[model samples]
Target chain A: MNTFLQLLNRVNSRVLFFGLLFVSLFLIVRNNEAQGKIFLNSAGRVTGFFGSGATAIGSYFNLRRENEKLQHEISVLRGQLAKDQYNTQVNIDTLQRVLDSTRIQIYKYIEATVVNNSVDKPKNYLTLNRGRHHGVKENMGVITADGVLGVVRYVSKYYCIVMSVLHTDSRVSAQIRGVDKGFYGSLVWRGKDPRFMQLIDIPKHNKISSKEDVVETTGFSTYYPPGVTIGKVFYHSIPPGSSNHLIQVKLNTNMANVRYAQIVVNVHADEINQLEARAKDEQ
Target chain B: MNSSSTLRISLKFIIIWILQIIVLKQVQFLPLGPYYYEAFVYPLFILLLPFGMHVNRLMLIAFFSGLLIDASYNTLGVHTASAVVLAFARPYILALVLPRGIDEAFTPSLGRLKFLPFLRYVIYAFLVYLPFYYTMVFFSHVFIVEIIVKSLLSFIVSVFFTLILAGILNGLD
Candidate 1:
């Protein structure tokens, strides 16, 4: 009985030490699982709670800059409108002189504020303040004052997530403004600086100008209106082993400081999408 | 049993968590190619836990810290699992590195050891961490080369950062 007590004591101490070690390791690991849900929930709550305050502060700081930009845009639009009104006769004459010159389309824009922006990841997403409640939906085109941002990927009641141009999965059918040969290329973030992006799959046969040619959407994709500005081709090179030319595009939109944006909701989007889907099915 | 010590530890954890979540999380220096790699600064928390702490307590602390970090980074349970592994391995590592006579009551601290012993401790700590960290991250069937490259780069960078942080904490103390 005395020997049994000693043995029990020895066993107890050893068990205790090992047990401590096991529990510590388990807790460290278990913490990860425990923390994930708790952290996310807490982050959401904290951000949601302080979101309004931060927005208010941001707006206050940006008021002057916003006013200045708004003024410049208003003046540019006014100047263009004046020119259109004065050149109505000229436009009519030109329409008669050229084929397909009279085709005019109107676009509606919904303004939204960017709440969160990420540019350094392979799959970058932007969160906006507007959502389904504001008539925003998946695949709607989003653009900043400078140019095209990306397309809306997901939507909630009060928020919408946009898969930015910086994402690997993001591709748009784009063409050189005046060139006849158009190509579908993926917009990829090179994980470098935020100001630059790479346009992949441009055929080597296509002659790319150094400085001035504009890259714009071809309207082949239902998400964007045809001729929406994307960026300008900055540089191109024939990679060592690949046949396609690697084109570097300087994005017009300054992603780092983008705040206010517009979501383009096409009225005929559903019909066009259905027709495209049927065509694909038939193929 | 002391309230002040508990408060100090909690404070330290919060500060480390905030720094990891808010500041270090944003800094991604990619020295490698298109296969994206970034340094994780959360291990400083693990390294900073009080030396010679009870094994279970240490593991619990590491677990909670890992959980907080994973949650912030949106990596579901990877950090927690790896951290727990590190916590469990820490004692064995200490035992292996420490001198025989010092095993009974020795705590891991810069002031408590010579240079070679410190280096050994750091090396062992790093070895314990690397495998678990890499395994959790690359669990999906990925290109072996990419996984190896990323893991190696991340391990090197994280170890260097951990050493610097540990040095700083020691200096401060």
Candidate 2:
């Protein structure tokens, strides 16, 4: 037992190092596939607690600009509401009221404050203050006033991590604005240039107008609503032997400075997904 | 260690941790172009721990502190692994730098090691820390060039900031 103790004592640090290293490696491997696990992701209580304190201090400096932006957003929303309002003329003493409850609401927005964000990495993520407790779920879309931000990839009680559009694997179905039934494509980030993204798979045969063409989400997927502006087309070129136009788009929302977002909750997502699954099984 | 000394060490950890997550993490030197990297002074917590502490205890301390930083950075195990490696390598590096063998109670600091030895110690520690960090971040041999290039760029800036921070917290000695 004394000799065994000597051996154990001799390699105690190495044993501990390898043991801890193994645990860390396990965390890295497990976390790579699913970022939603509460303990490993930033949405956990401990990380969120620290992130909130830091974000609070940082946001204090930008209050004026944030307020102005919110005010602008409110005005835009008000204009949209006015346009949708139906004006009815009353000829007699009968009162007319229009209840829009017949129109099923397909989308709901939950406002969230960004607790932590990073744009420099290959796979960037943003943490928001709202999470599972706030009706947030994995795969829901996140959007800013001007454009779409990302999809919620992980969630905990009071915080969640969004896989930002800046990530390499991020792909958003997008099309040119003002073009009904136009050819759509996928928007992808090339791991650089936070201000820009590449929209690919647009057929070369289609004519793209040069007048500051805007790109918007196609809403083909459950991730975003139809007609959400993504960016403006900056440049496009057709490579030799390729049948698609490589379009560069300048993003409207700056990924680095965005502090607030609204999570898009699709109420009919389950029905759509089930229908699609049945169709796939039939095929 | 006495209570006063323990309090001082705790204070150092708080200052360094805040400097790392709150200040340095947010300072993205965008002018550096694609080789973007954030400065890290939190490793100073492990480096500044009282000497003569067992390697087992030192590694454990480094592990926990790294987890704390990783929580804020959202990299999780990446920082923890790197910090542990640095902690394991630190004693050997210390022995190499100070060939004559030093006192057990002395904590490494700008004042304790003087200027030159202290600088060498910090450089060696970061050299181990940053490359391992970038490797874990990229996580594939396919990014070997990127790992090297990023490590070199980050090393220059991180070491500079760490020295400046060490100078400010010079009272630790």
Candidate 3:
């Protein structure tokens, strides 16, 4: 009788466990775009409040390094600004119309403080203090001063979630640092490492890349401006029965330490996407 | 139900919660390499609940505690699911580890269950919890490599820390 009781007890607990697990999975799956926004935003608000407090304390310890990073960025921007001013002085009359059409506010950056961030998950995300109220929108590209960060996934009144580049589903168009820019590939995280990601589907005929080869974001995507540093080629190998070289890359941004970032706003994205949608419809 | 037991459990929860978020959250598994796994001692709260606590009530508490932890960790539903599963597995794990006719009123701790049995219980409970948490986080079998590597590292580290915590709780008693 006792053995029978134990068996029934085991079966009862097993059923309870699975029933709850089913509900959890149901929550994950059903919490899609519209419904997920409500839950995520409400949760984000509470978390954001706490996270910001912790970040403020954390930021106090990091102020010196933060200042140095900003200073270095400012110096680089100063040099580029100087070159742009000189070029305009020399060629303004002839190139003014073209420059105004192509270069006038195509991409804008909205600065945001990282309230909360995680890198150790298969699907990592970051929560920023700036949100819809700050003109932050979903699908915008997030980048540090140094390297590619992620794309904005969801937005609330005063907060947003950026799906980090380390996410398994995150694929960014990236290219090797060379003249042959046409041979770019989609970079993806394999869920094992935050420090490394893989750029797959490079045709076998391309020369085996050296470890020194740098990788950067390509102009193929509306999310990021061209030439953002993504990572450097850490290693490469061709798996048997496949025609592409599996390129392992060492990510440039130390994701664990990123406390601030800029969101890329592509003014032309809607126009380009609408044009592409029309083409698809016609086909 | 009694004031002292209630106080002891509340104390356990507070100490474990702080140790988890403030201390262990900073403890990375491989500080230099891929940096995947994290040490989780918070689940020890669910593991060491009062032995007489009803399983349903335990699951409810586990779920809310997990939700609170998730609020801090930034991963919603994942830890909650793992904690509920841990709470469910606790009785079975206790049955497997404890000597027969042990008092139900007693909480399972290092002193009560003996060090080796309690260690085995932690291992067994983690075996249930980590796989569920990682699977839910990844949401795919393609990440088997990560799931295994992370689970193993988390189990080893969490068990070590939780055992120390269990010892401390026992000392308090």
Candidate 4:
């Protein structure tokens, strides 16, 4: 005990010195970001390099499980395709409507590895290995095999950052599957759990039930394609003073363990946005 | 200071940092419970700082270590701020809990202390560290109750791991 205390006293100054330096560095970095001078980009690259390396190691260990998951996904897709072919005669109008509404063609599924992900906070973001060189661009939608993940927020030459669906600032136009009209809701991660996200601004008039509803993207936002799965409603309640229902969605994608993902770059997103802007100008 | 000791300390820090960034961070013991509890290895850096190190210096190292972890994890400044705070409070916590005449220059070690004193140190460390860590992580939100609960839970789990690490390091030394 005496020796331990002696060591503690001796090292106290060193500890304090390092501690203060850290605090000052943190303050400088935080403050500098507000001034638009980011000194941490180099640090970010170093960290990113380490992160990507770690991710590679992790993926190596989980290869068997990932392979199984991919195989199952492939079979599921094949079954769905077969079923769709069979139902085409019975639902010609529905098929035509779906085809007409899908203006964007996803030419290829650009697989990117997630080097970093933040889901515990309000404004979560994800970093991917692919960027402009891989045909990935801003406004591209990202997803794992399970469901919708998020949209690309920033793109660099070889890497891209995605603002996750759990972000408070993430407003995706979505609705219950098969519902004609869509509603706008802000996705907010409650911080209690990562598997579930809270959807706000859903009108109280909409009929909702636990475990019975499927939420999908409305394609109103250029970031996601129509009918892409978002999550399933698990629980909902009307806040006391508001007319909107507070709905909790159990996300289909296990985001914490997501490894490989596809970034969907809609071919016609720019043209559609431009046309809409012109139409609004004429109006 | 001997060159060997400095080299050893630097090596330890580097090894721990790499293990934390590469191995421990990937260990997600998920589906275990409701909150997706995962082992966080960053606190081990704080626990392993040389005894008698200056509080400010310790904070700086802890902060940089945390910032590196945060940058890699894309958590921005949360880890850096919390780690600095944790390092700053360690000395005060030690003074408040440990008995007098415990030699001032002696670094903290489980092997050097009685069970009760060691337990007190562990508890104090958790109390000082957990709240700051969780607060920074959840800074944007105002859920005080959730914050307290999550912090406490994380503290309990992380403290266990820290104690084990401390024990192992002391045993090796």
Candidate 5:
């Protein structure tokens, strides 16, 4: 205790010098309004500078999570598009139509990240980080921004498996754009190239004049919306003695490296199915 | 430590303190834009304190003297903090400027050191004092340009007045 006191005694001048300085600084910050404001503002600026720097570095590590959040937001925005809504306005009269403008949202998109995907296999499938809880049902059409992916085959509580467009068994009803009422056919993969698909069963009687004819969804099935472009018609031929044309189509979406996809939820699917079932029962 | 010397020192302190508050405090030079600064000669008391005085005692005396000026100006700690810095630096500055073979009890005076050396000492002391004083006044480096301009301007006017005051005083010499 005595030695400690002696040690403190030797440094007492320094201690007092610093103590008085601290007191002066405290008084300046506490008493004078302008000086206090300057001090507080400068201190706040310093802390804020460091805080934003830390957030910048932390955000770099959080890119994947941030991407997922943005994807979800994009899905919500995609669902609100005018094309995604169904117009239920039956033309009773022009005046009545002006009074009644009813647009029902027929499709809601649920965004999902591709956890696993394969294009090299004969039967390719994609695993998505979405499930029944995310409103992804089996038979819901999966699509990217460019083209159709496949139908959702199976769904769990937290995940779903989608049959990719590159798969052998995958079939999509596709149409060719033309001036006349164009023809549509079942688009199928020929188990060879992942980038190309075969659109078959279009009757050769339909005039094929343009080389730039675009292959798109016919909207015949409940799987996809009308006019969703699947690909461009690359080549077509009437197989010997066959009445129908077999069209080779170049797919727009690159199936090998797809990272994100949206599951299309058709809201009136159950109603359409019931109506179709009644017609089948009558037959 | 004699009674007469003590009396003389006290009288000098009082005289300078009074002269600072009453006369120098009101002596406003024309404002040169935002670069205006006040003249301070109260620190001359700390500057001219006996060379043999302990640094700790010197600092305490300087602190109180500064506080007295602060009360009059309503700048409670700004002056005190600057004065304490001047008091703390006095010994080192004196060590640098004090001539060789000087007596141990030497107190700095105009008559003893004469004009040039005394001016040099005053310049060095104010060099330390004014910048620190302006720093305490402004309280932030955001006004760093203002601090430098004010310190330079105030240093010139202050040194001029302090030299004139020291020259007139007989007892201090």
Candidate 6:
């Protein structure tokens, strides 16, 4: 008894602190009103601020790793640039004025940093540093320098979240690289893997069959510029009695490692949207 | 142990409470940039209690003081929760900081513990209090990053004010 009292006496100052904490929590939970709600709202704002502060600290600690990543990224970009220049020049002679306009900037790329990103879930979203104030808006197609990613799902004044193409609802109009210009299909993800998406609705009779066929955005939609490399067709299957082939694609740009992305804002998006809206209205 | 020391603590409590409710309570960071938090030194009241004070008494005092602060700030129970926790952690902090634990008659003050030791102890206490306060306020695992960031930033600012106040009050001299 004396020993316990001795211990208690040693730590006596905090005797009631724990007891009160529970009772206080109980009061807080049970007796909340408008005042408590106001505090809650204020707390949300504070927590957001603090969360970013922690992120900044994490970034600071990860600066060395980030620097190494950038060095590797730059070297990769340099190699890709040489190849891209040659390819663009070779394709320019054979392509139409629409394709020519794409190279001449029908779409502008806004440089942005990935503030936050996720890819584990079925519906993965990424937050970009650009927002409504930075001319980013809802549905603006986002992509890395190498390939297509996803469209802007939501935007605030200074930040926006990208709904990655890995999501089930995300569908992009994509085409195989070849002689046939009109052979495009709706590309969709099967919600299984972040690294692969499936292109469905391609007519099985299209007869263009190849194992390593390259895929690119068709520019049939205003979301992505034409000829942005999406992935390579891994394999295709004619689903039993169905007339369409579902082609499995391996995405070129790894959605999980996307650090910096260029948000593709088609200058003609507004005009195209209006035209589409009017056509829908008439229908 | 003395009436004079108890009176001094009461006086310190009232002055700090008044300053907190009227002035420091309104001190919140600008809702801009990456970090947003409020630097609170009011929990220092619990930290300043005499070392040998019974835990039960200390916690009750902390609770009341926190409730009063909450009532004024329009955040009913937030300050209470934080204050009680700070009080609860005080003895443990003392035990951790002091190599010989705590003297039965020791009062946690700048005079007895010295400036640097006091600073270290107060900083540790603030770290514990601020993070808990923020966690309670946020109430979600999603804001985990925000809680940490806010706690760190708030720690720096709260420590600054706490040091200055500790220097001024000088505890039970």
- Please report the candidate that would top DockQ against the real structure: 6
Give the range where candidate 6 chain B is weakest over 10 consecutive residues by summed lDDT: B98-107
Best by TM-score: 5
Lowest summed lDDT over 10 consecutive residues: which window, candidate 2 chain B? B29-38
How would the docking of model 2 be graded? incorrect
> Per-residue CA lDDT of candidate 1, range A208-259, in tens?
7656678777787767778777789898788998878888888888887789
Comparing 2 and 5 on DockQ, the stronger one: 5
Cα deviation of B27, candidate 1, in Å: 74
Estimate, for each residue in B1-173, the C-alpha lDDT of model 3 and write its tens digit. 58898798888888988999999897766642664788888989998888887776677678788877877787767788889888988888888888889888888888988878888898998898888788777666667888887888778888888888888878766
lDDT of 3 by residue, A162-207 (tens): 9999899999998898886457889999898789999998898888
The DockQ for candidate 2, computed on C-alphas, is 0.18
**Cα miss at A176, model 3 (Å)?**
84
Alpha carbon lDDT of each predicted model: 0.69, 0.83, 0.81, 0.70, 0.82, 0.80
Q: How close is candidate 1 to the true structure, as a TM-score?
A: 0.39
| Candidate 4 structure quality by residue, lDDT tens digits, A1-283 | 5575456556656555565545545654564353124344455556577776655777889999999999999977886785633221222232123334556344345777798997778778899888876777898889777777888989987789998877766666767775443565765666567798787888988767546688777777677777778788888899899999898888889888778888876777888889999999999
TM-score of 5: 0.47
lDDT of 2 by residue, A1-283 (tens): 5574455447778888998787776666565544324224443456467776656767888999999999999977886896634222222211122338787778877777787999999999999887777678999999999898999999998788999999999999999987443789999999999999999999998878773899999999898998999899899999899999999999999999998898888888889999999999999
**Candidate achieving the largest lDDT:** 2
What candidate 4 gets wrong by more than 4 Å, as runs, is: A1-108, A179-186, A190-192, A280-283, B1-173
Point out where model 1 deviates above 4 Å.
Answer: A1-106, A179-184, B1-173
**Position B30, candidate 3: lDDT:** 66
TM-score of chain B of each: 0.80, 0.94, 0.94, 0.82, 0.95, 0.90
Per-model TM-score on C-alpha atoms: 0.39, 0.43, 0.41, 0.38, 0.47, 0.42
Ranking by DockQ: 6, 5, 2, 3, 4, 1
Ten-residue segment with the worst summed lDDT in candidate 5 chain B? B164-173
Task: Estimate the lDDT of model 5.
Answer: 0.82
- Looking at candidate 1, what is the lDDT of residue A17? 40
Model 3: colliding residue pairs: none
